[model samples]
Target: MTEPNGTTPSSDDDQIRKILETLLADDEDITARAVARLHPSIKAASSITRSESRSRLLAEYQQRQADYRRWRRRVAKRSGADTATSLADKDVRIAELEATVQLLTASHLAMLRAIGELGGFSKWAKFYEHHREARDRLAGFGAIPTAPVSSMPAEQGGKKIKR
Candidate 1:
């Protein structure tokens, strides 16, 4: 079967993969929904998300990020690079760190939100329960921080205040 562009299904898939790779390389949002919006012709974005291609790409990107984090940590340890040499260097480094933190936080919150949307709190809780060991490993690696929920300062409605 061929797509509307007279390309075979595999070719169409290749096109989609290329677009996805470009989006990832640019550090742009490439959620299935976002991709569908950006390219209206690809109508099966949700199905694509469940496909092996999407999973592979996501895994690859995650591995790259993990490698980057390990490299940065190693460099920091070797050079004690946490201290900036000048005020301008400090400002630039602070901005970069802030952006990284924000990106990681946003990615995590988005995943949590997706889980909630899929099956609410019960599913979210179940997910954590199922992944407890992996989560602990991540925390141990310092990829994620372990903090007590009660220790967080709450706002008026039980929501944690963002610092």
Candidate 2:
């Protein structure tokens, strides 16, 4: 807004600059020390006491702080020990599982060997016969007859396909 004769208003920058300059000029009532230390707690139970009494209180505070640190260290050590025990238990369980797996694998290999000795099951002649029989039962429904096992070339692996 303009003044009566159209003069623009003056800015308040000068006033702000003066205020900042005054504030930046250091004086009393301003110190780097903490305000809490300057004016301590005024509670009746914790009022400012003689230096001797304050020394005792300070020592007690320090002792408590030290005790808390010791407790924390003990807790950390105990947790580490517990973790070590858990790891040992896991190792034992893994060893037991490994033994069980070894036995199971041996048993499986033995069973397969036994089956191999009992005619190896290399040919599906018996299974084909049974499937043909079922298909014969379902005849007239477009069931196509397949060549019998006997029609196949004999002497496959020196074994006869039984009827």
Candidate 3:
């Protein structure tokens, strides 16, 4: 096309303009159609190149899919093992806590019973005094002496005792 200055556009400009117009068109699917039509050699080479590229991309995609599958399996196995280990550890910890609770409960009940036995402050003081006196007496006397009580089998209908 001639410019307003009366200058004619070059062949290169016309070719570039046509390619640009083709690009701006709605059908972007036509890759180098104009060039392929101008040069038959390039048309064959472009087709071969496109075919090789498509095959290479497909192979890479398949490899990546396989790798992803392996990775997913490994992740799932690790997560499952972690979950199982956590559950086992939790069970052990819970058992340990239950045992501790039982011990604490028994100790608490014993303390409550001991406190209940003391009816009042005076009774508590007397109880302490009685135990203290008995302990001191025992200490002074050394080991406690056992008393023997005799029961005659002839006095009652009873089983015979083996001495």
Candidate 4:
């Protein structure tokens, strides 16, 4: 039988036989030494390839972890900044409101002191005359009228009293 390349089976077998015969004819000790050297070289090459691949993988993983940590820190910083900004704005609003309340409280206290300086009845009468709505509102709540006492006595000794 002949192979597709047109070499007879016997001729092909003869070539393989001649090659093996030549290899077998070499000194056994020399062949063994050559094989031993070649084996160690192949093993060293494989080990170096494995070590390079492992080093590349380790470097890639470390870079990825470092990038992730940096990203998390950036996000945390932004959140902290946002919180600080919001707190600052809220503090400003609270300060403005406190100032407004203080002003209003001062005005109300001044009004009360001014009214108290006058005779209570005269103050209430003036307030009723000027602020009819406030007087009506107060009257709706049934507020009691107050009478002021004078320092002068009314009658002294059964005679008419003098001013």
Residue-pair clashes per candidate: 0, 0, 0, 0
Query: Which candidate number would show the highest lDDT if scored against the true structure?
Result: 1
The all-Cα superposition gives candidate 4 an RMSD in Å to the true structure of: 38.1
lDDT of 2 by residue, 1-163 (tens): 7534443323222322232233334321221121113332322223223335433443444465566666667667777878679779999999999788667656754544454445542343355475877545434332322322223334568998665
What C-alpha lDDT, on a 0 to 100 scale, does residue 35 get in candidate 2? 18
Model 2 ranges off by over 4 Å: 1-78, 121-163
TM-score to native of every candidate shown: 0.33, 0.28, 0.26, 0.27
List ranges where model 1 is wrong by over 4 Å.
3-7, 65-163
List the global CA lDDT of all models. Answer: 0.61, 0.44, 0.49, 0.50
Better of 2 and 3 by lDDT: 3
Name model 4 segments beyond 4 Å from true: 1-78, 121-163
Root-mean-square deviation of candidate 2: 30.3
Query: Which has the higher TM-score value, candidate number 2 or candidate number 3?
Result: 2
- Report the number of the highest-TM-score candidate: 1
Instruction: Report clash pairs, candidate 3.
Output: none
Q: Rank the candidates by lDDT, best first.
A: 1, 4, 3, 2
- Which of the predicted structures, 2 or 4, would earn the higher TM-score when compared with the native? 2
Question: TM-score rank, highest first?
Answer: 1, 2, 4, 3
lDDT tens digits, residue span 1-163, model 4: 7655666645533443343334334422222223223332222323222445433433444465566666667667777878678779999999999788667656754554456555354655675698888776654543423343333335668875877
